[model samples]
Target chain A: MTATQALVVPRGTGKTHHRPSRTWPMTVLGIIFLAIMVFPIYWMINSSLQANSGAATTAWFPVDLTFSGYEAAIQQQGGNLVTSLIIAIGTVVLTLVIATPAAYGLARFKMKGMTAFVFVLLITQMIPTIVIANALYALFNDWGLLNSYLGLILADSAAQIPFAIILMRAFMASLPQTLVEAALVDGANNFRAFVSIVVPISKNAIITAALFTFLGAWGDFLFALTLTSTPQVRPITLGIYNYLGANVQQWGPVMATAVIASVPAGLLLILAQKYIAAGALGGAIK
Target chain B: MTSLHVEAAEARSRPRPGGGRSRSRNRTLHYLTRWLFVAPAIIFVLVFFGYPIVQNVVMSLQDYTTATFYTGIAPWVGFENYAKVFGNPLFWTTVINTLLFTVGSIVFQFGIGMALALFFKRHFPLSGFLRSLLLLPWLLPLIASAAVWKWILDQGSGALNQFLGLFGVQPVPWLVSPSLALIAVIGVNIWLGIPFNTTILYSGLQAVPGELYEAAALDGAVGWKAFWHITWPSIRSVVSVVIVLGVVYTLKVVDIILGLTGGGPANSTQTLATWAYQNSFVQFLFGQGAAISNVLIAVSLVFSLAYLYMTRKEVDE
Candidate 1:
């Protein structure tokens, strides 16, 4: 999105050789905006570091740093963090396996019911997740999938797969048809041509989908709350939730746990910025 | 080589749009391959989305409870569940809460989001970086967001109160007060939603051809006049999309509320979504929960239909 930003930024901004007079005010105001938006995050980190440890009289800064919160947070929430990672990885693999081919087909083929299929995918997004969970709880119970990693992975992927398909399909739709058509001339079948030709071209889209799926599964609370009854398959999100349930005064550890869970998202923001931006806009526009 | 040539020739002949047995068989095979790709997704949708909807409706009509899980019997009660829901006084509170929460969140979120988008539209140094960083709140697992906000809004130790103390302002019992809980939830939700609205609205702002601004400037229509005439008109579709989606997404908000207040201080923060979860999971009254959710679904369906209608031209285009 910053790449797109360079086009619209004023001539006096980054494009210019020297600083412009008016740019400073806008920059100052912009920083103020960032500060307000990011202060809660700062507070979370600050309070986590303070020895006061959830005291009402927390200093503006840590003043005195402490690792006790981090120690407690890891000691308790570490297993759930691993659970989140496993579930997130499983969702990425499963979503890609299912959605990639479907996205390619929807983008490239003129299959019957294509419009209806797309429409269904869009409408499904509108359905409140509670409605799905209500049914899934019963279904998972009967299938003995409750509190299992596979169940949560499949359930979380349900939310990711449709959006992934739509996102990848949009990218795939713009690809030149001749890429795959040329491969067909070699004795490769449709699936083979797709695997060898189409898949390589859609790497960015697949990565975007994978990142989003990982995030969605890792951040998931609804399905994990509904489907998982025991601690065996609990996610980090739920660990923070259980911390809140205790309703303790020592929020230092709770904040630390939340900060731990948010690390990947922060890293992804700085590293995979473009794909993150694309996913943000593309998924919503559709 | 000859065989490849014949296959290419056959492919060229595909435009005939005719029906012969062999040609029809080939058409069936092609369709079959395409459907194969979509089949798994379709099956998942049917089992997950499709079945849930039908099951919810069916469950709503019966006396389904925790006992029914073991007995495999949920006697039909017809519209009794609906009647009871309509008669229940908490039902109305939930309806009002849902509307207030949805409308309040969307208004501020859209309003501030618009301001932020317009602010960042004028490209200054680091504007782009700051704008992207705004998404931090949104990208965090909402549960994590809720945990932080729950502490921040705490009457005593919360950061908000502590900050206010410097100004000699008394602590506000944000989540614990009945009148203030819903408002506080809306505030947190607005914070969560602002980044999304900004990103989309900013994208919409970008799509406005810059030439129009230049052209409008020549007409001496500057500032608000230029925006009202050119910018608003150009991005009206995006505004509609953002507003409608904000409404839809806000209507289904559960995790944040559950995390923050648990619909307490006399169930003040209970929206239809949280109420549905309370009935179904917490209280184990599946039928009543399903009934409440059906109403929520109806509400969502209205906005979703409006959204689809608004975006129809884009879809067709």
Candidate 2:
């Protein structure tokens, strides 16, 4: 599908018209399918709660529940979690600040070179993160950005900003042009009008962009793996990798750390379901 | 609202007292201000994406290494790095592994995703909820998923083995065995990719007109025949998109392999991406790594061009 076609087709719009009569049976089947697919997640949680002291003898259920794994994971990975949180928030802010205006421009301004700019944005999605990391390592080294939070945040923001622009621009393009024109006529300049009008009206798109950006930066491994040479700037992903490298026998804490690391995604999935759904489609087709 | 509209109309009709030169200058300032909106993004793309790509090409030719970091001197070595990479026997193994991994992951992910998408197309209670929940695996950090799968595929006490042992099967060395490591890594990648494939394909299925299916039912086109004749043709565009995007993505998969196998068991599971990573970071052979990654870039560019062509065709249609 073309990008515009994917955006134009409303999600699940056809479902209400032709509701199947025998849905419960299908629902049961869906639940089964879901269980099989998410079994690894269930196992991760179950193993996290069990005391598998350097052994593979983990109980299917956490019958003898223990907090020891949590204790160890918290003690070891807690700081990394904080570091990841800081970087994720930084990436979200940086990406949105850079991308929001660009989205508005691309949506509103029919300027020369806009099509080419949009094409470049699409091409950026195809560039591999390893390639970026490959060159950034040397650049960051020269610039003294290696092994720093700013360095990681900047790299992650570069990764996410293009996506944020494309996703948000799709939404902004559909917005009524008169809204901003109205603001401009009321003596506000373009930037002021955007700040007071466009930003407020585009809250949903902005939130979607922010959530995805946060998730992208939080889950980033390549930049954290390549850019940071020292443990002082480790994100939780690297924390888990380091844990795996050092303590393969201790599955409990490893699983516990995995569970801890998944909190943002899980929280967003539950609390921001609609936005997450919008983002899933937006991130892919756009 | 009425006053705002009146003001907007008045502003449009009002003529500036300034001369042509001043008005033109004002217009220039206005355009430049508009340019400010996208200027940062442009600069960012240049530095991050454009500059890196160029730097990779340059670095691949020079003898860039860890010592270059300390000495600040990378003498030009010309195609020596590329020669070393292509001459090595492991390069061919990596090339094959990369192909197998991308194809295997995309095929299974797309097939199973299409199946799930079709199943979910039927209206069902809680189907939406269950489908959304399936995104959890894709949402989690790749390393986190890798860690969980690493434990689950553990030979001794791993859950897969324990489950298999119920039928008198021996524990398989998934990541340890040279032959099986690539397959195991592919399996985990397939698991990670399924949700994205399903979500996109399911949305595509949703867009398929419901009346066509009803018409097909009337004409006795049901089950596989109905799907073959109607559903597949309708969603062909989306399928091409999903497959092409999947190829582009699966080609550069590094985190999962790094997390799961570290391209180990004597580098049995190493793909070009991971091998480049190993060359650069693990071995401090930045030039060779850049050369390998440049080759990966070229391969990706082919598919990326195909994708752009397909999408552009889609737009034209």
Candidate 3:
């Protein structure tokens, strides 16, 4: 949050709220630091637009912006981008279906060892993806799930299920227990009460959880890299890495892929910023 | 009708399970259905998180290989894989690299993040917009960022070298040279980490009551003294959580190193994470890979346990 919240709506009649000296100098300083931090990203986009003309130097601006690289990128990586989308969407659906109920259960029910169970869930977040990948590789190999969309979806969700549970549970916890409890008196079973009341009431939290799982699955590289061997199943994150390896001479297409690859992070910041913040806080606080 | 509904609710909410054997059985069934909501999540986490941790340990003890992928046999090799990984010179180099990478990242990220948080604490136009924009680094996939950094840090035609050329300084081999590769990687990691640190630290600063600062100002505690006395104490919990989570997350960094240098230029940027990936996938030394990762896991568990301890009160409440 910015000091706008403090200034426009007085939180307290204290020095923090009434620091009326809003300065342009601070804005300039903040912008300078931001530019420093984001220069690489700028260069990535700038390079993506410019043609790689075998020149030793890159143009500071895309003065003569070319679409050749993007054309090549689309020609080559469009399928991989589609693959990433399908996986991300699949993850969102799967996570919501599974994590929503679990979160409601944990937040509402009096499960034995609930505290210990939640603690263990938090610890699961710290388990390196490599450890999970190592075991999953063997297990998937055995179960014939490797190189399949279902496999990656299951793996990514398994890795993400704990965080999803914690996040949605934190949100769902605020719903008065009587909401579902009341529904139970209407001759509805527990499952019906959850579907009819809790799920509909917690729409924002569910979307937040779903968006986060979307982002996670979209940006996932470790699982994409280690689990899938065939190009038929490669996500764009892995496709980008593979492009960097195979097309060593083409920085243009690579940067183009990078830019295209950043769409979710960009769109989410612009569109669903509120939900993202809620999810971030949920992860930290819960 | 209302009385009948209340009766039904009372029947469902009975405190004692002694009405009859049939009633107790129904209670058990009711509770089982209630638990079914959480059962899938618990089972998934167990098979995923719980099983892998134990499997990694077991695999580290055994001799798993690419061949074992088909053969379905990884014979017990005892501690040989662990011994082999430790005895290797690359292991020590990676350990040192891991420490330097983690420490360098945390120190700069925290310092810069704190400074930014303090700056943004005051009111200004576009402050919120700019603050959110800072999260772009986190949103960009680490692999994408790494690819861009590789281009920017490219020695021969890099944007950095070209910028330095304007200063009449010679082009520096940022990623090619062994001595500078780790530093370069650390620098990029710090850049990636700053937004996260700043966002969290800024939130922490927001929670510090305005009244505390006002009270301190009345006592002539301005600037540094006010910060030390008022701000630090209030934000200490968030600060610890930030740094601990930073360490835990930073240790598992693989995509960036892989994208930027593939842990190359004589393996200068190789940490335990990248090393583990290389051994298992690249070199087909699955057992050794699992061994190094287990070490990484052990290091991570220390901080995660600390994290759990710190958050226990918040979680329970």
Candidate 4:
């Protein structure tokens, strides 16, 4: 048994190494590629901590680090940050509410043109948001929703639902049919069965959808910037633009605000890393 | 699994409706409930998302601007805006630039993504963490990601130049040179896009059965040969989907350019999206801007229709 166990371990190792020990070449290439990708984030973090002049100095690392940039950005954008948070959170809540039930219906019932509904959603996703940005601004202004949190929420919420529906539906359809049938035979009404049986089984997928909606809401820039004029309702992303329009570039604070704004989405990505990876790959390719 | 949990809970709470009898009132209630479940989403989209699209079409025809303020139709331009759009040299330049950027970014992005996906398939230790970390560029909001890139690519004292100096190469003006600026922006876009493609392709690759590769190896296929013979066939559907979606997405990209170059250093980097934005927002040339957007929409629609057709063909086949 000892000999057999020892044999199994090397066999596993041998099979993997069959590809070759070209580690030097592969690692060098990978490091170059990853450096190109990672440098920007590194730059952002580095510059965020440096003073204004220090940022323009030829140092990749912060020679003199400070949190004044953060302090200033937060002081300036404290209200805006709260507004962005509200809009993002609101978009997620609204999307989940609308999409979850529709997804359930699409999954369980043999609705007419269900495939068509999915197609419609794919089409909508294809349309560039900028194409409709001006028109939306005009319409929102007409309806007295321009520069309002509710307007941005409504726009983003609309964009998010189709995806949420499809994601939930796919997860639902993959579920065993007999479970729903069993619930029916157990005398639960359709609504009650869907609520209890379908919803619970699709929890992971729903959570994945919720996470995606949150990312979309948080990352949204064109719509948020275009629709809102006032600092009161503008998201953190739009606030970054104000830095560009200032008398000077203010690279330190800009980087600081950028890092600050990215934290929520970055944290979301790191925390939901598994679900997000699964969702990104599965949601599209599968 | 929320669905499964819901099913189990339903099993305990309600009395079983026997299979044999199809009750009329129950079926009616089911449909009504389903409709109710779906209505709010549909209404929300129709009011906000759907209505704006119709308004866009109407706005494109009017010669409204900041001055006119939509106080009636300025004139019934009637494709005059569109004709002028086509006639504009800058419009054509933007269109060409947009196409090039999209094509360039997609090719490199997909190539690197595919390579990474194939590498990840071997399942080395800690590969999962690497894959997750790889999502950082895609995960960061575009503004932040682009801002970070802007700082790194800044001409005077950015990270890229500073790093290059260590190797004794002269510092290059990444975002200041017209020829290099577009490519620089493209490079950042590729970074943001590759992790996403890798994840998607990796998942697609995983769904391909290991048995085929085993069989191919048994028949003496190795490395590239085995992958070509087995993996490619299995992932054809997914690859097609990715290509179509990638084209549509890359075409619509504006934020990265806006944040990084502002379509600047002589407008060499202007794409249709940014051009549309600059026209309406900066110049306040609403009519021409609307026309520019209409053209973009038309181009994108053609791409989407092709995608839809391919998807249909895949389903049919």
Interface RMSD of each: 6.5, 6.3, 6.8, 8.4
Candidate 1 lDDT tens digits, B88-139: 9999999999989999999999999999999888887787788889988878
Worst 10 residues of 4 chain A by lDDT: A1-10
- lDDT of candidate 4 over B1-317, digit per residue (tens): 12322442353344446543345445545556656666676666666556666766777787767756556446767877777778989887898899889999999988988999888667554455666677778778898887777777767777777777779978798988988998998998888889878867776776676778888899998898987888888888667767777888888898888888889879989999999888877787777788888788888899888777766642222
User: What's model 4's overall lDDT?
Assistant: 0.74
Query: Who wins the lDDT comparison?
Result: 2
Count of backbone collisions in candidate 1: 0
B177-236 in candidate 2: lDDT tens per residue? 999999999999999999999988988988888899999999999999999999999999
Best-to-worst order by DockQ is 2, 1, 3, 4
Using DockQ as the yardstick, the better of models 1 and 3 is 1
TM-scores of chain B alone in all candidate structures, in the order given: 0.93, 0.92, 0.94, 0.87
Tens digits of per-residue lDDT for model 1 on A36-109? 98888888888788766666577788889898899999999999999999999999999999999989888887
Pick out the ten consecutive residues of candidate 1 chain B with the lowest summed lDDT. B1-10
Sort every candidate by lDDT, greatest first: 2, 1, 3, 4
DockQ of each: 0.49, 0.54, 0.47, 0.34
lDDT per model, in order? Answer: 0.84, 0.88, 0.83, 0.74
Give the per-residue lDDT of model 2 (tens digit) for A19-85: 4656677888899999989999999999999887347467788999998899999999899999999
Better of 2 and 3 by lDDT: 2
- Candidate 3 residue-wise lDDT, B1-317, digit = tens: 12323433454565664678788768967866866887777678778888788889999999999889898899999999999999999999999999999999999999999999888787566677788888889888888998899888887788999899999989899988999999999999999888878877777787787789889999999999999999999888888988888898889888988988889789899999999999988898889999998999999999999988877775575
The window of 10 residues in a row where model 4 chain B has the poorest summed lDDT is: B1-10
